[model samples]
Target: HLVLILCMFLYINSVLLFTLRSKSVFCETSRYILLYNLLFADTVYLISSSLLYLLAAFRIKLTFYMCSVVILPPVLVYSVSPLTLTVMSLERFVAICYPLRHAVIITIRSTGVAITLVWLSSSLNIIIRVLMLLCSNTEFSFDLQMKDFCSEEALFRVPMYYYFVTAYSGIVFLSAGVTIICSYIGVTLVARSASTNKASARKASQTLLLHLFQLGLILISTFHSNIITAAATIMERSHVLRLHSLSFIFLNILPRCLSTFIYGFRDQTIRPFLIQHLCCQLK
Candidate 1:
């Protein structure tokens, strides 16, 4: 059942990704380009994460190196969603608030540069985490089979490493939340302007709100481990197992699938094209 759900969402994301690149308009626009980056990152994360989940479910204990290979990429890509979202919010803000300069500020070349920076920054953080994990683990070895279940928590055994992750997650989400909120406020103020296009402004405002909701889902997915741990303390073992499975679905799978609906259904331009492609694929 779980595999079925993951595959279904993966198929939807794959279709939406293809739809975005199917036309020149989607390729040329700054917002769609950013959406492509976001969807691509989310898709990668979903694949890696689902793989890890299946590994754990089957009780397949991986070696230290194998665990890192399976888990670290998801961690790296995890940061990309929020960061890409921040960029997307800023793009919308510019489009509505500064309509005249939106073109000059957010070009195709600049969007490419922005995406490059996002990946570079995320890679740097993961590299640092791995280096620090190595330095801290005196007995760490490539051949070491994991004693616990394979997850991020299994790799981050040291106190400082966990602390560093907590701090980094806080900083990333804090900055992202603030940027999205500020962008929403800016759009709202612009909507009140006498000369602003009321319909466009309203749509942009709703989009920004959806971004916030999506960010919130991403935020929940990140802290799901903590939530499960806390709940296990009070619940029976059987209940905890059930709760864990539920968390994996709602927190992990559902959040990643939402980007498709939020943009695919909401954007009129993409809606018809996405529907046509989906129907053709169904047939």
Candidate 2:
């Protein structure tokens, strides 16, 4: 709990400092707007997870309403984050591939709309997920206690919806994964093929690599735990607990923490200010 709290504090302050220092530059650009939203989403996820961990550690019982309101929504909304990454990657692809027409193609308003749509679809998907679980329970005449199963694994165990939810979610994951991979792959190819600007091509490859690294981390962190938690016999309690702890730190915390820095430093617009802030703090 203390660790999570410290992380949240650092993450929030870092974002606040960055945002406040670059308000004009950040608020003016569509790419920055999407990045800001992504960061905010991560911030919310961190806070909610921290509170949930704190409560669990204290053995506090969260009511169905409380879990639904506090826990599930944030987790569900967090699913939108990878989708947001895909959008950002697409933005980069357009910029790299269609450099001459990038500005005209991806305007500020269109980017906002894209981000908004991602959130909307994510919410609907989550809603369907919850409803499916509830409907399945009702159909099977099983007790539907939303509060009982706070974990994703428990949610999947809910009878009738199990297969459908798994299938649907798998499809959603695959779609987003494909989109991100494809976009970055295209950017990498375009960058490599350009003979004139070797430096730009190298930079593009670097960016794609970062995107792929983050994507792989997110997928493993998000889905790998589910498999681990499901296979009860594979890991002993202590081992599972240790793995969970490590996952919480590396998968949940480190990736998000690194992403904010990557987004801030990767964009040339913000690099100068970020460097200035870092040097000032070092002094």
Model 1 misplaced stretches (Cα beyond 4 Å): 281-283
**All models: lDDT?**
0.90, 0.67
Residue 32 lDDT (model 1) = 96
Query: Tens-digit lDDT track for model 1 on 31-93?
Result: 999999999999999999999988888989999889988988799999999999999999999
| Model 2, span 167-267: residue lDDT tens | 75576567777877787677667766745355665676576567667767766666655755675578788887677666677777665655556767676
Misplaced by over 4 Å in model 2 are 1-21, 137-149, 153-157, 193-196, 224-236, 275-283
Best by TM-score: 1
| Number of the top-ranking candidate, with lDDT as the measure | 1
Could you tell me which 10 consecutive residues in candidate 2 have the lowest summed lDDT?
140-149
RMSD of 1: 1.4
Error of 2 at 143 (Å): 13
